[model samples]
Target: KSKNPPFMQWTDEKIAALAPNDSTERRGRTLASSAKWNTIATNYEAIWGECKGSGSQPYLVQIKLSGPKYKCSCPVRKPPCKHVLGLFFLFAKSSAVFKYQAPTEALKNWLDQQSTSTVSSASKTLAPVLKTEEAIEQAKLAKQKRWAQRVQLMTSGMDELELWLTDLIRQGIANTDIQKASFWNQVAAKMVDAKLPRISTYLKETHLLIQQNQNWSEVVVARLGALYLWAESFKKRNLLSAEMQEELYQSLGKIIKKADILAQHPSSKDLWFVLGKKEGVDIEGRSFRKIWLQGQKTKQQALILDYAFGSMGYEQQYIVGDLLDGALVYYSKAYPQRAIFESFESAKIYEKTTLNTYKDLNSMLTSYGKALVQNPWLFSFPVGLSNLKAFVNDKKELQIKDVKDRIIPLSNLKEAIIWKILAISGGHSVSLFGEWSGLHFEPLSMLTEDGILSFT
Candidate 1:
């Protein structure tokens, strides 16, 4: 999907229906074949309505098949989208041809012989668990090997290029250097030859920016982050989560066209802090961290950047939510879709200090205040509607929840839960379990090298 250009006929909306509800735009991508679907009798065709977006063209793509597998690219995340349905409609009537030929008697006979011989030779009588484990191990090994090879090929070339560029900088390319367009053009050409398309594209973009960009440092920083991300992706392709993998691919795709959002300041004058820096870490890919710390008449607040990481031609810096991070982060509304500030260290401020422990208003501001000397303005700020507790009325006043002490910032829900849990444990430590999230509780015991806690 990333390989395809802007003019490519496919769009995100077309991917929706054919995918599972839990499936994401870049996930749940089994892409089963006709034979594969024959085993499960899968595939379904469903349609919703006309397109709804900023576009003017009447674009339509839907599921065209179901039961024997399907394909669609709508935003729904359900499989067998309307396009796949329509495609299969032709298939059901024997009109359209598949990517592969139909099973022939000759081919079937050969396959049968091969299957028989393979089964006999391989000993299919192995225990299911052992067989499954062996298959998984083999798959892991194969994937590791493939990623290793790709990383080896891409990184070495990029490293050489980075060093070469650094040398040019040392020799002062700004003053005098090679003038031939063929110099960089040839480098870009070599990247394609090496199959390092990401690096190749980066070189081409950098050359263009140097030749045409009004702001070179900003462009360089943004592209540098993306190139670093692609290199990191090559390094850890086997370990990336589906969401992270999708993000890596998305960043790589935008390396040629996007800008670094970290350098772009919002119109509002607010103190933003660095919660996480992707330049030094691999988890957030090629992004950086900046948290907006706004202030009210009485206290300060934090609004996560949850970087609107889409479409803007720049480097994006994402912020963290108060409560979600690490494993539990996988479960939430915007879930799997998280920003940089969402890191544990960046978002959490759980202190065993005291109730309303903030000494003064200035001290209460986020770490951003010390550097920017501004505040998180509550009166006129870009607040999100997702926070149910912070919903605004027609009069523009915050709706207060009876359960909360005063009108709590909607962003404090998750943070409040963590504080509540900490209060219960008196900030020592507590073992979390299914019961904590509402489940039948039973006696439990936890042990560490220092001590043990037993529930009776």
Candidate 2:
């Protein structure tokens, strides 16, 4: 097979895209220019090499082109560390250096291990479905009993939380001092013990906001009210609609597993345009990557999340700006936004032309408010608007103005990048996409006639 295959060419631009940062890209370019690799070999699925690094022995480097996974016997910690990037750059610019041969023994062994690991994972996934009907019934009863115990614990935690909030309000939030982190940490620990981990997380994040934000008194109080409202709602959950109850339970940390989502939910097919990708590390040190996608035909948005533990890298199965013809099963929620892919008919590089956008600020906010009503615990909601202009306001803060001149402050944007976005627009209105976090809009990407420029 051709190393630089027809559909997937490992060109210089593609290699540049793969590099994690500009520093890494520059280093890879320098290494490739110096011809650092001593031996380079390629197979249909992989590229292997021995790079003469600044060490006694040459470093062994292997790239699983299919997995787009990189492994190098070097001290570098990041994925596709300098060596792998240089190898890819060489493969792209001068394929003549790589011998078209079968994989070496080491490479073969690694490939075999990867295959075995995948098979083992697939087998483990089937275990949940193997329970007999009687066993499933028993499990269900056991789960219900455990849930009852959790509810009792949670009630106690909520009672304590209510008293704490009442005390804080009575003392006045302006007079309160939250500098002691334990004020939040202790309550978060209690919630965790109560099996209300999601609530615990909300409290922890609120503590961060209290430290960082100037208007934190109002923000924290509002969030506390929302939390207390959710807790109270849970007390009368049976009176709520099925969708609302599902949303409540999910926000309370009742997770539906992958197998259940795949097996039970109905699938909806669309040509999904990936809008943006964000990667984050949680307090528990787990790595999470979320890809936001919007259907061209359906005009609906979906979020796909991938997670990894320590030292493990998430497999990036999709890329931004690509169109996937896929069927996705939606997770149960009042506002269904997250989904798991069920099947894909095909995928291709798609050129975006028109954006599904609101005509005015009122239109967008109305929709967002409706979604919040459906699920008050919603973190961020998507907003797309056309003929939107971005500029710095009097306070030097980035803001987006619609045709009607109604504007919202843009949060989380660097001042320099805001200028760049203005340059990209060239003083004219453009299509904009962002997330509304109750107070301000965090711009994700801007669409021009040429392409999408991601802010994340």
Q: Least lDDT summed over 10 consecutive residues: which range in candidate 1?
A: 434-443
Tell me each candidate's TM-score: 0.27, 0.81
Query: Model 1, residue 136: displacement in angstroms?
Result: 3.3
User: Can you give the lDDT of residue 226 in candidate 1?
Assistant: 52
Q: What does candidate 2's lDDT look like per residue over 9-88, in tens digits? A: 55576567566667878888777743677888877567788889777899998887653567899987656677888888
**What does candidate 1 score on TM?**
0.27
Please report how far candidate 1 places residue 8 from its true position, in Å. Answer: 30
**Top lDDT: which candidate number?**
2
Point to the candidate with the largest TM-score. Answer: 2
Q: Which stretches in model 2 have alpha-carbon errors above 4 Å?
A: 1-5, 8-27, 38-78, 91-134, 176-179, 282-286, 343-346, 349-354
How many clashes would you count in candidate 1? Answer: 54
279-302, model 1: which lDDT tens digit per residue?
Answer: 111122333222333222212234
